[model samples]
Target: MITKGDGMGGARRHGGRPDLVRARVQQGMSQESAAQALGVTPTTWARWERGEQGVRASYRPRMAALFGVSAVEVERWIEGWSHGETSSWPTTDLGDSSPAATVKSAALLWRLEMDPSRRHLLASLPFVPSALGEWLVSWNYGTPAASAARRGAGRVVGLADVARINEARKAFGQMDQRFGAGLVRPVVVEYLNGTVAPLLRGHYDDRVGSELMTAAAGMTWMAGWTAFDLNRHGQAQQHFGQALRLAKTGDDPLTGVWALAALTRQAIHLEQGTWAVWLARAAADTARRAEAPPRVMSLILVKEAWATALQVKSAEIRDGRRAKQVERLLTEAERAYAKGTTDRDPEWTSRFEAAELNAEVGVCWRLLGEHRRAADCAEAAVTEFSERLPRSVQFNQVHAAEAYLGMGELEQALGTARAAIPVTKALTSARSVDLLQRFSGQLEPYGDTVAVREFRDHLNSELIA
Candidate 1:
């Protein structure tokens, strides 16, 4: 019998029998089948049925389809209320970036990331910080700083071991560049937990320990970055935080600053413009404190400019003052780039060359409402993004498309979007997928047109297939 109740009150409205369970039973499907259909774990499905978790409203349509029920029926079944009884479930999204929550979430991520099998369990974990914070304390909050005086008493480790680890780290970085983070995160995480963790605990002298810790910290940063690329923001936050702690422990200020810069990128993509600015400034300040080489400093400055551009584009008051500040930051970035040579910077900064810089400047201008310049810079950057950086090319293509859309060049936007589709399709970066999704949303107004519809269809086929 279908039980109905007034669209008020809690799960008690249906005597604590969640409609999710009822719907599934009615459809004659087991939890495993439902989970398989939804592409989630059976455990996750159980939680939903038991009311231990709430389903994202965006997922409702698919859930409804899977359960062989109308979307309205699923909604009524889950909430024990009819339409208009409450706000949509999306309003209840638990993801937020308060400082305390961020730290707690990062710590949890550090644990979860070490166990690949348990990583799936993270989907059930409550909201973690969606991005990293700027403060030095943020990184060191949950973890202890490594001390130089502490020496491992196991088998003695030497500079050769540390060098090998760095080499492995570099190799993983190259893989990520060519194939995207989704393809490389597992390998990186395995290396960290399997190989690097052992070396960290092995016997080493003071100097070797410092180098080893710093190397480990660098790998951690890479892990965090890969997580971010894969759209695992909380995991990314935790990894970066871990890396920062390791950097401090090893007394490697440069790595710590770079970790902060990575966090800034997270904030920017997560649309926390204010947080992005804060993190970027912290990175620059940290660099200055360490007297970082001009090349590294220049990279940090550009990151700040990028963050500032995000702020200006997203702010209610997009006036000349904000625009000028963005320009000033960009000018400083250019000067730094001019003054510093790549040879003086770390291997990591090698990828942030002229092409990358141009792409950033283009994106900055686009966000600030300078569509013409943004398009030009973006187009040029696209040409400069060689095969070495597959994901970057895909990312810049989306930027180019956005510029065209802003300038009302619908055909150009559609064309550019289509070209970027295949590039993003093969890559596992969640940010890359998000960019395409956002681009699709941007085309919704013009979706009635043949070109726009064709592009949308192409996108849907690629993503869904």
Candidate 2:
């Protein structure tokens, strides 16, 4: 069984929580009944009462409701029961900039994700937009020490081990892009916990260790991207933070920038435009500091454009200046992208080619109310993306359909949307499903039309099946 401890000899001793037992008894509920009410097994509940396991933050409110006490009181009781022991509950905090701390936190996160029960609590955690500021500040200024060789009980790691991780990341990343996160995320999480975590604890020289950390950071970023695609925002945020810390520990500024860009994408998706812009800017600054390749700079510029477009979308009035700013950023992104690939471009940069750039530009145009340009960009993206990339194809198709709807071409919109239905059905991405649902919402005004009605009927049926 997975044990709850700080991984630093802070494991909880056998200490019983008389207060919790009293609360349950006062409610006249057996342990089994309480566990059932709380949607956990009896053993887990018992562990909580016995201080063998710490209660997750997400479950505190439910426990409060069950015991007719405030959530704070439940937390106090838990703390009191623990008798000043360090709670081993998984946290999203990046911890200190130390290499050892980074490895410990990454391992903890992977374990939390691998545990079925803990993963459930993780999914329920809320996304905190406010946390972005602190994270960005830390990443921007925090300078971690260079990774050095470590003496450990595990096997010695070498360059070959790091290469294996990079290879696996590529294979898993391809699956994520084509099949969506729902199918690939769990496997990636398991791999992190079972394979990468062990290698991190193994002995390796500075060169091997740094390369290993960089490779691990890439995989962690992939895990975050998959979680984001699956709409697990909390999980995504934690993974991204961990990836950033890993990159810092590895002394890989470009990978750190990549993590920052992922956070910007999440912020944009959450509609925290200001935070998105800040993150994107930080990413660009870091890229320039690292002298990142033109392709990498292009990716960061597009993210900034997307974030700027969001700000424009949220404005009470059409902000022409901000709209123009977005256009300028996209133009710059195009120019940088045109500079083409270089030897310095990382393997991950290959995925953000013309199709991805156009798709993102299409989104910026859509947000700016330029439906004609958005439609053209979306169609170009759709044609450029390979059939293997079903999620991207469906996302762009949805954008195309939305652009048609904006243009009042209901038939064209319906046709474009219908084209995405098959791919949507096959993919497991929550984002794609959500996009289609949003498109359906846009069709509410045309509900009375026969074609719209029939299309909605077909879409609904396919979505449900």
Candidate 3:
């Protein structure tokens, strides 16, 4: 009564599912009957067995029950069927403080990035806001011990290799700033998988190994940043997490601070204000432990201010106390930024100069409903940003436009936003496009005026074309 050839053909065609097929046979259940028990269609069951689709987490328990196997065993069978695809990878375990484990985890992530078939699945992974808290806890309490040189049969890496990675990181970062992530992320991933990954697995002394890990952390952070620019949230989060672990393993708390701050920004973007605030605070604490430069502290404070401003915005009735807190944080950030750069400042901190600070502060002001101050700060940021960062210029231009819109200056807003169109069209940043889209939504109150109509036409043409 097992029903001849039911689901077995699909399983055989897909291959590597002999165990799954045997489980069904032992239970004396046809594919149709199993599907009925699981409350899924027969075709869905067939696809699952064929490795064409994944088993949902909710269905795994029932599946384990039906097969008389543990849930973990069910997962292992699915993973085997998929040939251990990135889809089966767990999002938890940000990697321990061991250099070997860090390298292994980072290599896995780079491979995930490079695999075309599984890249979409990785991007589709949900952003876990709760992970921010776990990461913070680990970062605060985790003390990594020095790892011994590996005796693996891989090439011996050196400081020269570490130098090359840092140089490549700088180049990729510069390109990403100018052109956006769409053009730079692929090349960065290629370098990480093809070049950096092998070096990480290779042999090296503690000194060289630590530097190598730190260098790799920088490149990985760049990879995450570009993914974020392209609005690939889940992929960005994973890269950031891996980067944090790599930094910890490398004994480079400064780089770890950067990763934490990046997570804070991502949390803010996702509107998880509480997580953002905590992550930013954690970044500040880590930076202090590293004795980071003033500019670094300024950057962390700005992130904290941004998160606090959001909290104020989300209040049912504008929270005055939090509003004052935002202002105080911004003031402290400005004071710290004024101390300027030093020899100790990391290369990555260069991007958070005056223009970036003004841009972020303007955002805080706009959220607090101070339209005039927001417009002035935004315009200042626009003027300060150079052509070397076309994407930044475009982003600030849109922010200026939004601030103008906030003040009911339709013509000025439209004109400022129009100025960004050319640059926006040239760049590949999803965030820039998203900002423009939101600005378009804000123009609805203008009721199809000639200026508004013309602007909309231009935007539609540029975006669609």
Span of ten consecutive residues with least summed lDDT in model 2: 81-90
lDDT per residue as tens, model 1, 44-68: 6776676655555456668867866
- Global CA lDDT computed for model 1: 0.72
- From the highest TM-score down, the ranking of the candidates is 2, 3, 1
The residue pairs that clash in candidate 1, if any, are: 146-249
Better of 1 and 3 by TM-score: 3
- Model 3: colliding residue pairs: none
Any runs in candidate 3 off by more than 4 Å, and if so which? 1-87, 90-92
TM-score of each: 0.75, 0.87, 0.84
lDDT of each: 0.72, 0.85, 0.83
Weakest 10 consecutive residues of candidate 1 by summed lDDT: 88-97
Give the worst 10-residue stretch by lDDT in candidate 3. Answer: 1-10
TM-score of 3: 0.84
What tens digits encode model 3's per-residue C-alpha lDDT throughout 1-465? 011123222112345455666678789988899999999999988777665555565676688788887554665565553423433463535437787777778888898777653465566555778777777777788877467355556898889999999999999988998898999999999999999999988989989888888899899999899989888887899889888888888788899899999999998988999999999999998888788999999999999999999999998999999999999999999999999889999888988878899999999999999988988888888788767789888988888898898989999999999999999889988988988988998899995799999999989998998
Candidate number of the best TM-score: 2
After superposition, the stretches of candidate 1 with alpha carbons farther than 4 Å from their true spots are 1-111, 114-117, 123-135, 138-149, 342-344
lDDT tens per residue, model 2, 135-239:
777787776765546666789999999999999999998998888899998899999999999999988888887888899899889888998998888789888
